[model samples]
Target: MIGDAWLWVAVEWSPPSYGLPFTDQEFDTPTTVALVVAAVVKAAFLWLILRAPAPGPMDRRTKALRRLLYLTVAYDLVLWYPLALLLDTVVAAFDLALWTSLNVLFLLVIRWRSRALRATAGTMFALELAGMADALLDELDLPELGSNDAVGFVLALGGAAAIVLTVVGQRRDGRWSRGTLVAGWAFVGSFALMISVVALADMLFSGGLVEGIALDALGLVPAVWLAATARELPTDIGPADRPPARRRELRVAMAAVALLPIVALVHPEQSAHHSFTGASPPCYDQPHFGDLKPSERDAAFLCQARIRYSGVPPIFPDTLPDQAVLAYGRALCRAKDREEEREILTRAGSERPDSGMDPWDLVYVCPEVVGATRPELLRSAEEQKAANDAYIAEANARCRDPWPRTKGVAQATANYFLFVDGDPGYLVQDPGDKAAEQAAGLAMDRVYDDDTLIGVGGSAVLVGHVEDVSDLCLTVKAFRAAPPRRVAGWDYVNEVPIVSRSGQLTVPEMDGGDVGAGAPMPNLAIRGKGRYRLRVYVRADDSGEQHLVVVFPGASRKRLQLKP
Candidate 1:
């Protein structure tokens, strides 16, 4: 029954995942099988023992053996299980070491009760420890016989030996001598001390001080119980007096010893490396990437390849300035003999002294290159009104709205300039009272959901308003002349899209502004050299017809014509 219980507990506590190379699902079946087999074997052994004749009345030897078995079982249940399994997360390494130590101690106790059982139990324990060491060494990639591993092994073996000596003396002398008593106490003390040291070392290296201390305190209970119980067994009994119970007691001890090797054989090994040389398999014999099949290799490569960007900017920063977008644009213009496009690029490049022509020609500009401005100052009332009037006239010209009333109407315009061939630059305009501002705020909030989206920018124009509109006309012409769908490679380049929030649009606070020549809004470029998509959310004070026009270099103008 005790063996059955221990087996069940071991299966529950460690499961197969504890040290095996099986997936999670595999553990369930194997664990159930192992536990059932162990229980059946243990039950059979117990039945046989009960049927056997009592060797004799229980003698001192028999009593001592019984006490040792009880102690070992109690220690394993109370100390080893909780510390190793229950408190694994906080002090996994420490718990493992302590559990290993307890196993050694338990084997030694069994050996003392029945020397004939030693060959089996000792060999099993040794092999199990060897396997554990092998796994640890492989996992940690440590040097052989490192200080920690050597000390731990010595402590465990020494503790086991001490228990054996104490048990042997009691059997021979009928009572424990003062020296034996002291040694027994010292063994318990040393065990506790070693556990404390291991816990503390784990705490210092890893960060679980509170858990280490708690587990150490819990470990003391079993140590005390074992020492006190083992000390009570009588030291002597005559052969005739012990005959009745001796057979059963010895049989139980032998069964325990035999079970060890069986358990060891069935125990799946962990893929850990031990610090000891003899504990591990040779490196060349271990599995490696090359051992994977062709299918696996193909799958791995495909998984990596899907995320590669063909023309998109590298996500990470580069030491050399990013110039892909500007260079691509310039090369395209030069190939097409577009002198005006080349001159525009050259002028923007020359303005920045340090970078010379490099900044303007780069695929994208660093956000730092664009000077900071108050978000409010990006547009003014007069500029906004004139732009709105021109937009309305243009819209009216396109679609005849006989009864147009533009009051309380939201308006906005967004323009995107791309130097390569892909998605053309986009623009959005809201023209209804203060609705545009609300729309922009909502859009900004959405873009910044993940803390990644930055600001937006583009030229704001009032169509069909100015009598002498050479400057405004030139700005539009210049925008129309640039190549389409091409990007400027600059620092901090990213692709961002404006997504609208749900529900009716609400107008936010708006300080009406007019955008005109020499206004900061026209020149207020953020990260000056990169292509951008501008979104304008606005409401016209009075409505006739509102036009949100998006002009791209060398592409037809996209006009969002609306009337309110």
Candidate 2:
């Protein structure tokens, strides 16, 4: 199965479509047949053991060994059934490593007295450790192991040596006939062959599917061979025949060997390398957020693709960056499969609505942490939906007429509104905010005393009123702090248009009655909900400069009757 999959991946699965050809053909019949065969073989192996003369009053040591043997087989079954018949994840990639570990552990236990067997365990353990070392290097962003094939080649040579030693050492022991020794060594040799085949297959067909039926059928070959050989071993053992002194060494060696492969194959690095940073379908060249790092963007793409395609669940690093998680949520929201998209997105977060409110507008009002806003604390999708529904319901109950979004920030009943303008480049130009607090306080005080003032806030420039206009917007553009020569000490950009409620456009005069030409903002009609314009009017005097605040009308979609 591994061989076929590897072949398919290399020849058939190419870039932009690195997956097996889905035939819609199920492997039910073949899988069932393989399972039935394995069951019969297992039952017979158990029958042979139970039917044997109880080792002539089995010793405690013998009983323990028998228990361990049973556990080995049981564990194999536990992992194999689901994997062979129903597994669908990338976990299948580690099947070879897991099987080899289990087999080596079993062999080490049963054949502890043989020096040759111990040597084989050591070699395999070392080879597995090298694989793990390579994985570790990759995770650390270090140079990768120069050649995976080099490790495989070394392991194959070691396996051959192990087989030869197994035969020679078993023969010297004289525990059984030459036939038995050769048969056991043949099993060892077959295991070695299996490892080589699996490795080569992976190299050939990296990410394609194999014939499930053939795969399952082939899996049974080792189990049947192992069982058949085990059933034939003699039931009796003498006290001297068991090597107690060597058991501890064998156990330690095998335990270490078994654990290395699990660590290498199941580590987080194994799952994260297959992300779609460059791909178009899974990830676009220009992502939703282009500023993200390659790793962050790739994580986002893979996170969404796994959910969309029902691919293997990716193992993420424990300490994923905050931006990366946000990116993943955004990508997940773009999935075409609405059901899965919602399921994954809601689990992460609701995709942040593109409010289009410029960050420059809010920086003056919010001098601290203006760019640090994150949606990590948003409520679950269901709760958010409920909140939205409740707000809409309450709004409907209060107002008889439907609120048209085109009305911008205007309310149905309110006649007066409050607005304030501050230094457009205050965040960038005067990040120290030497005069921001006083200016904002003065403007806020004006609104607090007035009844017509619905809401008052400061913005850098007028962004035309529109649907999804948020109060805060963050731009990466650099702010130039260069001040006008006439203004002195502080930077002043330009004059801004002041639109009357009756739709008249005029520039507000500065402190010297100088009508400075202002830059054109988004021209928006002064409907009740239209965008409000605020311009900082700088007045030069002997005591430096002061900005005259003019109040325009600005309101948010949400309304509250503070005075009425």
Candidate 3:
């Protein structure tokens, strides 16, 4: 329950911008190393502290150390763990709080009861066993393990019973040996059950037993600690004569010990965002236009193309302009037919604008010739009508479906299909609609913790200037090269070219141009028959040394080449 609550809080409060830059493998190394080191240090400290001779009557240093350890352990289990749980839950809204809280609570109970520490440890071991069972079930994608509510109720009742038994047994005989023994055996039995479940799951599912083993190891820690400390009990002692100073020292030591493992678990290279400039390989300093060797020029062109088209700085060693130009040139060279050459040349010509070229003329000539071959690429007026009909059908079906089961499913399914199918144009045919949908989706997705469906909408505002619509076409084409996989969920859209320009390519304010009241032209285009193409129609007054800016959400921009 706490885990669920924490997950809710995390999902609601966390920003969408924060994400780990490295892959799981890349991030695991430092975290694993840190955890290992911390664990070793903690174990060493615990051993040394336990091995130290009992203070005869009293020793101040021992008392101080014990107090520190107690405080540290208390802080970690009671304060730090809870806080971390809260933070994590708030950030992702995943149900991890229950696991974190239970772990800490078990540790605390063990610390409070020296004689029954073994029992407490054993109970924790049992919980770990249950945790392993749960993990295995999840890995296997098994049916819900009972219901969450049922599981929570059972756990609560079990905890209450254990507490009652401990309190009653302790008060009656000043020792809970029988109860402890029973609890220990029960816990061990639970562990055995979990092992069986894991083994079965491994056979059925093929893998995931390793996770169960890791969980089991985690569960055994308290039991090991209890066993190591069990031999030193003074039998006739009562609560009145218990050493407060010694208790404090033990707590402090345990805390210090715990800190070691946590430190080791965190990855060192976990960055929220990656800077592409740092990752890309070296490239030429200048625009090597027709002077360099073909290969070198190709490399430089790729770098420029990436820079100009991506709007983001280079993530790889190539430039955007060079890449676009080389690609266009290659297409031209390989053309076997007159029609193919025209199409390829049209695509190549659309990339860079001549210094004195009229923006409107360029937009008119390029998109018409280049985009003509791929009429199907453009979402037709009729197709838009069809999409509207499909969306309505889906929405109506959603209402008819059972509650919760299909409430969010239709929208999610549509978004997923859109992403998987690599067609942002389906979501919106016009630039303004595209921008609006993208913004709205982003906002809504954050609120619902539905990153999977909401991430497909493309940004509307261009980040950099383009010489002509051809540049814009190329930029958009590159952006559409690879759509995100719906199942995997969208993290980043790959190969989106950002277009940067030497001069400004500003759009007129709403009142200043024909774009304000009238419907905007759809930016959708398709590649066909070895050539790039799109259809372009423009209002008369909308003319200039136009710059088409393509911006990816988190990437840099680059320029596309207009001609070979």
Per-candidate TM-score against the hidden true structure: 0.24, 0.37, 0.23
Question: For model 2, what is the error of residue 365's alpha carbon versus the real structure, in angstroms, after optimal superposition?
Answer: 31
Question: Model 3's lDDT to the true fold?
Answer: 0.33
What tens digits encode model 1's per-residue C-alpha lDDT throughout 335-452? 3234654554354442212222222112112212311322222234455456666664453244322112321122222121112332112223223324555644454444333322
Query: Least lDDT summed over 10 consecutive residues: which range in candidate 3?
Result: 409-418
Give the better candidate number (2 or 3) by TM-score: 2
Model 1 worst lDDT window (10 residues): 469-478
Q: Write the per-residue lDDT of candidate 2 for residues 410-439, one digit (tens) a residue.
A: 112110111224322111111123443453
Model 2 TM-score, all chains together: 0.37
State the local distance difference test value for candidate 2: 0.38
Rank ordering of all candidates by TM-score, starting from the highest: 2, 1, 3
| Model 2, position 304: C-alpha lDDT score | 41
Give per-residue CA lDDT, model 3, range 460-560, as digits (tens): 22222122221111112112332222222212222222111211111222232212111122223222112111111111113221111221222333322
